[model samples]
Target: MFGSLPLGILQLWHRKFRLLTATLGIAFAVILVFMQMELKEALYASAVRYHEALGYDLIMLSPKTPHIVAARGFPRNRLYQAQGIKGVSSVSPIYLGQAIWRHPSEPLNRRSIFVLGFDPDDRGFEKLLSPTVLQRLRLPYQVSYDRLARPEFGPIGQMIDEGMTVRNQVNDSEFTVAGLHAIGSGFAIEGSIFTSDLNFQRMFPERSASVIEFGLIHLDPGAAVEGVRREILDALPKDIRVLTRKEFAQLEIDHWSKATPTGVVFGFGVVMGLFVGAIIVYQILYSDVQDHLQEYATLLAMGYPHRYLKVIVLQEALVLAILGFLPGLVLSVELFRLTAESAHLPLEMSLNNALTVFALTLGMCVFSGLLTLRRLRSVDPAEVF
Candidate 1:
């Protein structure tokens, strides 16, 4: 196997231009697959950013709430009832809504931004906001702008960072930008704001404080989370749905991946990339096999077993897989960084993703080589003679 490996590589190296072209083809496919997978993952990750940010043992939402951005208001009393549960430490009411944010500089231009309203004293957003930012949020009509929001939001984040007093109009109600936070924009929402529950109600006067969008339940130390969650479910009315943190995050992921067209489109892209890659690899391998047919037949005439030639082709495939995957991986990582910075989406290249793409590339090349095996097997010594 070791002896045949070098022979396979040398044969490919002898035709440097073909080797370069084949490697580039495989690399292009790898980049396509990587981008599609990363975008799909970013869709799910960004969709659940709010869910994962909150500090909660369990969460409660109205059954009618389709997603976090479109959360429906439920009675605040449901959270009060859950607070009475044995293992429950506390419950905080959260409000979610959308309001037209008039651009700070451009008065006529308005854009919809997601607003998250909760008590500054509550632990619900302890993980998401700093104590300083939370304190500022307590001030009436003071809001925190998302630093990762799109540039169209009119540099509120930049002004805040520069310690300038930034105020913006939301639904025609003036609000101060007290601070900045880093919750990124998702596909559905361009930007987000964090404000106290009082300010939230003030912006949307029709939305009563008694009706809340989410209830975050924190469990006591050493308390059984599942047990308390079950008790809360039993105590709450059918209108409210209870879910653990993991379940809540999964809910958002499932909605985007299964219910929406984003996942399907990216998935189809991955398959197409693989198909194109396979065809390129097959052509390379088939052409190489045809070019070397007489040599293969001469080996057979010299009593070289069929297994020997099979090993050479397989080794060649393995070589191509590795050579192609390396450049693809590097380019993909750089592209992910550029996309993340420019788009402000959570596009991370995880280890699992890298390994998965590598595996797929290897499989694609080997399968192509196997398809060329039929031609390899038919190389008769008599015909060559």
Candidate 2:
């Protein structure tokens, strides 16, 4: 069957000005959808960067621990019990807390910072922090500061690089920036500081040695993570929770995605983008169909089937999708880079994200075309004079 694609393409281009306007509308919609989704993804990516940097197979936490930022301490004996599991190799306790960082440079300025205390001997986080940096952390009051922490922390990273240990207040107690790491910032906190568990206790003397915030479980080679997780979950008391490192990271993501208002806002933005795009595309398609109604009526009188007209409209919609998507995709990539650099976020453009947005664009245009069909179907052959 000879289809109406050629005619559809010709008709769309015939009105060059309208065609350009429609194309721009579609592109705008694409950019909106792209940025909304990319920002949501970036939030999760940056939130989990800390977890991803750790070299551990399983993560153990207190059941009260909703997420890393609010982690509560659990009994150290639970970690010992985990080490006895069949596939278990070793378990390292990690202490987590928050402290007000009194800016060393500005006495009046202060901000909250995350604190991570781990046994220097375990070296569980050695993948992210070099041995030398971890060794430096062993010295009391000595701590490694995140290089990517927000500037409010008073140039802690720079001070460390210059071979100077700048003194600052951590929860009203004095602490030093002995080294620098690049763990990046999260939504709840501006930056993070790493130190030995002993030093951490020295800074926060209220924290007990018998309680730890997290337990990093390293399994023997070829160990089944799911099985170990189940084993640990069943063996541990109700106060403890055991999960694979991946599951732990997802726990943090899920907390941000569903448990917080930020997730709702981002999701709402995405939906609004789609709605805005659909409306714009529908208007363009409806206008085109209206302009060509007399011609469509004439064609129907000439015995062309209604399905042929539908094909033409759909082809036009698809063309708009492709043309709009190309520029939108390019713009989104550049925007993602700018966001990552300027905002110090981990925003990225992945193939999956691209494919997802492309599918949404196609659906948006096709749905718009469907709405335009109402006008096409109403064209009566007999109405044409």
RMSD to the true structure for each prediction, in A, is: 1.6, 2.4
After superposition, candidate 1 runs with Cα above 4 Å error: none
Top lDDT prediction, candidate number = 1
Q: Please, what is the TM-score per model?
A: 0.95, 0.91
Worst 10 residues of 2 by lDDT: 1-10
Where in model 2 is the C-alpha error above 4 Å?
A: 1-3, 84-87, 162-165, 220-236
Question: Model 1, range 224-287, lDDT digits (tens) per residue?
Answer: 9889988988987898999998999888888788888888999999999889889988998898
Judge candidate 2 at residue 220 and give its lDDT: 93
Candidate lDDT scores, in order, read 0.90, 0.85
Please give the clash total of every predicted structure, in order: 0, 0
Which candidate should be chosen as best, given TM-score against the real structure? 1
What TM-score number comes out for model 2?
0.91
